[model samples]
Every structure is written in C-alpha cells, then in structure tokens.
Target: MFALGCLALIVLPLLGFIAGLVMGGQGAGLWGAGIGLIAALLMSATAALALVKAGRKR
Candidate 1:
C-alpha cells in the first residue's frame, strides 16, 4: 500500500507533464515538466526517509 502510494505520487505528475508537453507547447511544457520532476523527486525522498525511519523502528 505504501509503495503503491509512493509510486502514484511519482508517476502521476510525470504523466501530467508529458501530457502538458504534448498539448501546451515548449515554454509552458518545460515549466510544468520541471515542477513535476521536482515534485516527484521530493516525494521519492520523503518515501525513502519514511522507509528508513520504519526500518530503524523495527
């Protein structure tokens, strides 16, 4: 469940960014893609931290 949530967090933004690039043209698409990538990275980091904390607790 946790993994699925994290995966969704990472993938949804990426898909949206790709869609934006296809429909919105270069400038807006680049901005959206940058934001999406940053968001995905942040979510991935948060998930990794949570996993580490969980492991330490056990």
Candidate 2:
C-alpha cells in the first residue's frame, strides 16, 4: 500500500504530463494537473484512513 501510494504520488503526474503533451491541446496541461491532483487526494485519503484504522487498535 505504501508503495502504491508512493507510485501514485510520483509516477501518476509524470505519466499524465507526458500523455497530455502527446495529445496536444490548449487544456492538455490542465487535464494532466487535474489527474495528478485527484490521484494525490485519493492516495492521501487512503493513507489517512489506514493510519486512523491502525491507531484504533491500540
């Protein structure tokens, strides 16, 4: 899970940017940024939930 989160945080945005550039449009950059942001938020939420759940066991 940690590795997945790390991957999403790093690779997701890089892939998005490359894809956007390949596609080529006025809003291509925006699309990549949006994708990156959404991925980041999702990963963060997952991580937070995991932490909370783990803490409750104590």
Q: Compared with the true structure, what per-residue lDDT tens digits does model 2 show for residues 3-55?
A: 77877887777777778877986379668867986887699789878978998
- The per-residue C-alpha lDDT of model 2 at residue 10 equals 75
The reply for model 2, stretches above 4 Å from the true place, is 25-27
Per-model TM-score versus the true fold: 0.63, 0.67
lDDT of 1 by residue, 1-20 (tens): 35755776767677767877
lDDT of the candidates, in the order given: 0.73, 0.79
Count of steric clashes across candidates, in order? 0, 0
